[model samples]
Target chain A: MSEPPARRRLGPALLAVGWLVLLLPPFYLSAFWLQTGLFAMAAVIAAIGLNLLVGTAGQLSLGHAFFLAVGAYGYTWLAGSPAADEGLSGLRLPPAVAFVAAVLLTGVAGALFSPVSGRLRAMYLGVATLALVFVGQHILLNATSVTGGFNGRSVPPLTVFGFVFGDTDDGLTVFDVPFGGLERLWYLGLLLVAVASLLARNLLRGRPGRALGALRDSETAAAVMGVHPARYRAAAFTVSSMYAGAAGALLALVFQRIVPDYFSLGLSMSFLAMVVIGGLGSVGGAAAGAVFVTVLPQLLGHFADRIPLVVAPGSTGTGLDASDAADFLYGAALVLTLVFAPDGLAGLLRRLRLPRPRLRAATPQTSAVGEPAVGDTLKEQTL
Target chain B: MSAGIDVPELRVHDVTVRFAGLTALDGVSFTVAPGSIHALVGPNGAGKSTTFNVLSGVYRVASGSVRFGDAELTALAPHRIAALGIARTFQNIVLTRGTVADNLMLGRHTLTRAGFLTSALRLPHVRGEQRAHRERVREIADFTGLGARFDTPVSLLSYGERKRVELARALCMEPKLLLLDEPVAGLNTAERAAMARTVASVRDALGLSVLIVEHDMGLVMRMSDEVTVLDFGRRISGGTPQQVQRDPAVIAAYLGGATDAPVGEETR
Candidate 1:
């Protein structure tokens, strides 16, 4: 008998809808709104990479933004200078080649540098990566030859053939309405996010995916099962770095200049907050987190600045309280959501959509509450 | 005839393990014959686990060497020892973070050449390799009576079932030597018998050299072909299971010493 249609088609259907949601929205969004959307999409690209290293491999890396910085600076230098950027040297190559080179160089840097983290795990690795950001900022500040030093570098505007993609991308006449940089970028952002989602989906679903999970579970068990935990962990770190690198390049494209302050420790924390809010190791959660964080602040700031009323008799006031209130709200949202739903937004949604698992039946046999599944039982063996 | 099976072997030469001035293993020496189930039995603190840890590369040997078919195992990492076709199961089961199928597939990790980028991209080669591993894992699970629950996360399985899953994962490595530590500990009579049967079947089917460390006298006697008994960090006697059972030192060690090691908190 033929397999049920639902069984055969469910995966493809989900994949299709996922891409369509990401790609088709630029036509409907205004320029300002599209800018926000594009920014969020870039954040998702970076977050997925961090998720692979921190969430899946259990290798904590706090300096993920350093790789993005590397990519941004590398791309900008190559695009801006004749020597560094082979494409921008008056003999402009295709934008696609420059893009590919940016990504590959970032990946090679990640792979080469990841050996530092090969022997480290958890907090120490995080601290080491944290050191990278502080050290990286110096390279950004003093390396006048490459990154234009602290003044940073202006990347040559991205151009596809002679189409001119950045501020110079000839305006689009859509339904007689014109759109430009932000609008075009909205679609680009969507495409990149879609690509990141697909890559993460495939990686986490199969053999290598399982090996990553196994490495997180137990080094000894992973070894006995013929897995090299250190090797796979290093590989995950490198790929994750590449993702951050790509995202940085996107940022450089968006701003037309790559700056040291943009890829700072604060940015790294922002990325972590996004992943935590979304749910670690979850694709949809990461995107949702990026959207909420990127969008909420602007909406709150605009609304606060526009409101013109104060409830005081003797005091003059800006609606500073309103923005503060929004900040409070976001913080409260993080605390309440995390305290009650530790798995983040995706897990909360999962629990709401499905029945609570029949875990009580199986839990006492092993101490697995800390990890989602299997790991608890496996941990029992390791202990 | 050589009496033992003809395959690559592991030689443990005068290895000792020291911890903070205490000697866990003192000049321990032995050889595991290929395809032969050699039993390492001892008192609770007699350093059997310590020796297993050393061989598995979890604990670095203080002195001497371990040669696996001529490759020196000392100073090499744990995963390297594993890749050399020496796989083991812990006295405690470490199942990993997924379903039974996922756990077993982890065993094929060294065998599989696909990388994170390949898997992430869903490249054709990685996809084909994933499919092949799934089938191999299914066969291993079937051998260990875990065929029916391949989709179920291992956390849901019972203790006996989890142990079986651990064995299934180790088997997936397709090891030359299988080191099992107290494989049937805490099992009920029926469960213990089932576990013994699984052990025997895995050895025969996979053609692996088996070295089991067990304190269960009856199970050890039933499962082992040759026994090396240890007491107080030293070898007391060596013989067939019956002979070891009758050895005075082995009898005293089992009859009087602190054979009770509360399993303790597991490693994650």
Candidate 2:
């Protein structure tokens, strides 16, 4: 069936408007907002990857933070110059190469776990992956020469083709606004998010996505339709790990320091929260969810003094801490989303967009003459 | 709608399967000639579904072998069996959540070459391949009389329409052998007649072998060229509908040996 011309054009028009809106943030927003946006962008990339595995492929993972740590540490170790005095070892590779390599390294880590990931299903796989986070924490804490142990290591400024993402004496300015590390990296984050979203959207709308969707619905049906369950599961996990790696690398650049404690089980849970709260399999929904989860805590912390019943960090009072408040809000959101809109925000948005009840009546009558009216009645019954 | 690949004879030789301590199928053997309709008929728990599972590699056989052309199907994985041009529909409708076109495109999985990377990148070749497949899928949907519902989401379709979607999806594979499990089990009389017509036309037009597991004897007798009857996991009778209709053992197994009349005569 042909869609209305206006409706067909609406998607691209809205997309263009969104891109324009995102482009203005670096120029107009303060450093705090820019940092939060960058973190959200990173989350968006990771959440999309996780959604592919958990939502689309129907594989559950609880060790996404392990892969992210792999990416973060992988980049730091590869790009940091060796410091003999501190007993730190590094490859001192170019920042660009290190960035790409870090992602690949996480993919390799995921591939290494494929024997277990490919065999296990749903909750079993989640428990298996939970071990990765603990194992990763142990390595990060003990690997003194590579990871810098308890104190953590400072992240090297990302330099690409003689241009640095960090502050430079060159004093680069555009439209009378000084562009520092955050501003420069904002564009980079945007580019990466765009590419990641496009790639995910393409994948989900194509042959591989359908195969994975089929697998999620029924393994027997998927297999009979020529989709290898284990192979696809492994592939999805590897891809997801690479996405987490990229996010981790970007996060390192944003945070300006790499710490083992930050890449804990809590981080993985937040990522899971992002995808689930957004919508299981929708790319846009995951991005929105990531922004909501990442930005809410930071915003609460920023405005905690003004907002009643919420206190700033390190403050002891009768009120809840900002982080706790953020947690409570999203936990309630998760519950509400599950109860009212089980398909998540994406499905909710779709229902709002379409006049579904009316459309059933509006459907064209195409049955041949003398045919029984069984289809019409059945449709009504199902509805 | 004829596939370019040659249809292959499906030879099940003394196939036996057991789950735990229970034997689900014991030494059941049947051969489906190329370009013919073969029906596997039995009462509930008579191992019809078990045999279908075995043939499709969902379940491993305890003994005996199933061969499609020269390939030994018993040792291969399910996807590998599908790759060898065996496509099937579940007894219960198992259509994925999407438009009819999406489900039909899934049938082309064995035929299409686009992988995760190319699909993610939306490479030129992937688009071309999808367009080509979409055209053929639409044609198959028309063949199944689901042309009007091509773009309709499967959730919106009636039960009979969903069954047709499954059939169209199987046809999209362009398989040499099609396995249908209870194709018209839940359809109304009119819908059942329409489904029978579609099955007959698909076999006639595509010239592919079909092994059907059906509870409806009227549809089975009217459409199938040969019938294999199972009783308590054993092959009790095998022949044309008329031959099996008169077999005392077939009648006894169907009616619990209470009468000598042919099975399903009253229902037919």
What lDDT tens digits, residue by residue, belong to model 1 across residues B58-79?
A: 8898898998887888878888
Residue B221 in candidate 1, Cα distance off native in Å: 0.8
Candidate 1 global TM-score: 0.87
Model 1 chain A poorest 10 in a row by lDDT: A374-383
For every prediction, compared with the true complex, DockQ reads 0.41, 0.48
Total clashing pairs in model 2: 0
Q: Relative to the unseen true structure, what is the C-alpha lDDT of residue A376 in candidate 2, on a scale of 0 to 100?
A: 36
lDDT per residue as tens, model 2, A1-383:
23568877997899899998999887899999999999999999999999999888888999999999999999999999999999999999999999999999999999999999888987899999999999999999999888899889888879999899876777999998999999999999999999999999999899999998888888889999999999998988999999999999999999989899999999999999998889888999899899999999999999999999999989977799999999999999989987877667876776666666635432322211112224532421110
Worst 10 residues of 2 chain A by lDDT: A364-373
Residue-level lDDT of model 1, residues A198-288, one tens digit each, is 8887888766677777777676666656677777777888888889988888878887777788778877877777787887767788778
- Which residue pairs show backbone clashes in model 2? none
- Kindly give the stretch of ten consecutive residues in candidate 1 chain B with the minimal lDDT sum: B259-268
